[model samples]
Target: MKAAQCSDYTSTNTYESVLTVQESVPTPNLEYDTPPAGFKNPMLVRVLSVALAPGDVRVMTGDTRELQGPPSMPYTPGGDVCGVVVEMPKESKKKGGWSFGVGDRIAARFVNKPMGMLGEYALVSPDVCDKVPESISNDAAAALVSSAAVAVIISDYIKEGDRVLIYGAGGGVGSHLCQAVRLKGASYVVGVGKDAKRLKSKPISCDESVNYTKDDAFNNKEWQDKPFDVVVDLVGGIWPKLVDQNQSEKSIVKSANQGGRYLTTTPDSAIFQGRSVWQILRVFLFPALWRATYTRIGFSRSYRPQYSYVIGLPSTSDIVTRTLSLAEEGKLIPCIDDSGPFPFTTEGVRDAFRLQASRHAKGKIIIKVSEK
Candidate 1:
């Protein structure tokens, strides 16, 4: 089987040395990867398209391994996959409690394991697999699964008529999140990013857009006057830079409604690229810091708002299903960047990672793994 493999980790030129296409890698055995617990069903899928994510870039650069353990060797590093089901045992489907059959076009978010979708084939568990509708393109289907899953999960926190502010709202995940919140009946959806043009590129219906590079955008009187009820921050730790320097703290306090909910997906120093040992330590320590007694007590007393770090779980089959349905209905327009799909090659895969590492893509970066 020909596939791209992350054979080693690099400190400097991460993707250049870490990933390469190999011609003779053995195909995955569907029966071998399935668990003895009988909870996960295995589906051998002929890969069609796979999407690049920030997590894939982090994995390539070895940032995650320093804090967590290293990944298995010769790994394929992708999360979201759109593919055709080539084989699935009846017992596997029964055990996993899914009704899809062979040859069905499906999309899935695989668990954070060595096996990935950036290959000729991938073994997907049923819990993460959702049938992609005929109306959705392979690229869109591949791109939407993971981001839409996160949006669906986070939408649980949203309320009717809440004014929502999404940081990094111009990016792939943030754009879908904007739609999800809007569909939930947000009174206003304001997006904050460095590029106002990219932020407004898609008609995702963000009522207001902010370019943080502009002077004092966050604390600008317009935003301060219309305080938000929920803040969904996809960009972490950099929010302070977007606020007014003098009243950064007070402005954030004033901007949210009483008991406002603040959610961020990137809580670790991975967002910072883990440049130094201190940053690596921060990656491991951030979660602990959030749980600290004094930190918790102070936030509870002073802010009176709920702050949560969100992680998307692949086991949310219901969310995945609903997201696919929304995509088919044309309600969720995925913001795939202007740089369209990447061909399934060593160069394409490498370039995909570079685009992901840039942190400025307006939409999802997709790899066309196999021609349909």
Candidate 2:
């Protein structure tokens, strides 16, 4: 099988040297006996399409090796995949517990693995897999698997008539998140990103778009009066920036209504640069500690919104099914980057990673691995 392999976490300029398209990578075998205790046995899939994620770039650059443990050399990197099941576990066929069979089109997000869904063939567990609807294209399905699952989880936090604010609102998860909050009946949605035009366009359609390059929406007077009820920060560094030495009260905290929920997907701005245990702990604990103690113990009664670092977990099959149904109904749009889905070649994959690393991609950067 042909697969894109990374030789090492080297400099981005040397991607051509570090990354290669190999012709004879061995196919993964299914373990019927050792199928992770309760999980179903793995299925061999014929890759159709794959989506590039921030994590892919992080891993390629050796940014997350300390936290996630380094991958073995010459590993394939991709998790969001849309593919067809070429072979199934014998037990799955005999027990009849599997929802899908050989030849079924599926989308899956493989977790905690080095050899991921970026090859001509890959093995996937059923737990994180979902059947892709006929209405959804392979590229779109690949794009949606991980990001949309996270968006759906985030949407659960939204309440009817709540005012929502999203940081990094033009990327993959951010785009899906924008639509997810709207679907959950948010009264208003404000999106902050570099690309204001795309954030306010169709699919994402944020009620208001803030270009972070031109303006500071957090400190702006315009949003001072209209505080948000829910703030989802996909980009880090905002929380620390919220504190102003000049102001008695943190003005950025004032951007959110009292008791508003502030959820962040990353611990800090250095997430991709490499995070120390202390740095990670500070980002995770500071807000919680402040909310729990500082507000109550201090002379001032002013309170910042509740803060949390949210990690997107592997979604259940039910959530995946619902997400696909929503996409099928045209209620949830899988936002692919305007420049992609890139072709599945060595150079094509390299370019896709370059776009993803640039952080300017309008939405999900997709790689078309094979024809549908």
Tell me, what's the RMSD of every candidate?
3.9, 3.5
Q: What are the per-model numbers of colliding residue pairs?
A: 0, 0
Where's the lowest-lDDT run of ten residues in candidate 1? Answer: 248-257
Candidate 2, superposed: residue stretches over 4 Å from native = 31-40, 66-71, 92-96, 245-257, 273-301
Top candidate on lDDT is 2
| Candidate 1 segments whose C-alpha is farther than 4 A from its true place | 32-40, 66-71, 93-96, 238-257, 272-304
Displacement of the residue 366 alpha carbon in candidate 2, Å: 0.5
lDDT of 1 by residue, 91-121 (tens): 6435545657788989887564424677798
Q: TM-scores of the models, in the given order?
A: 0.85, 0.88
Model 2, 38: alpha-carbon shift in Å? 15
Q: Give the TM-score of candidate 2.
A: 0.88
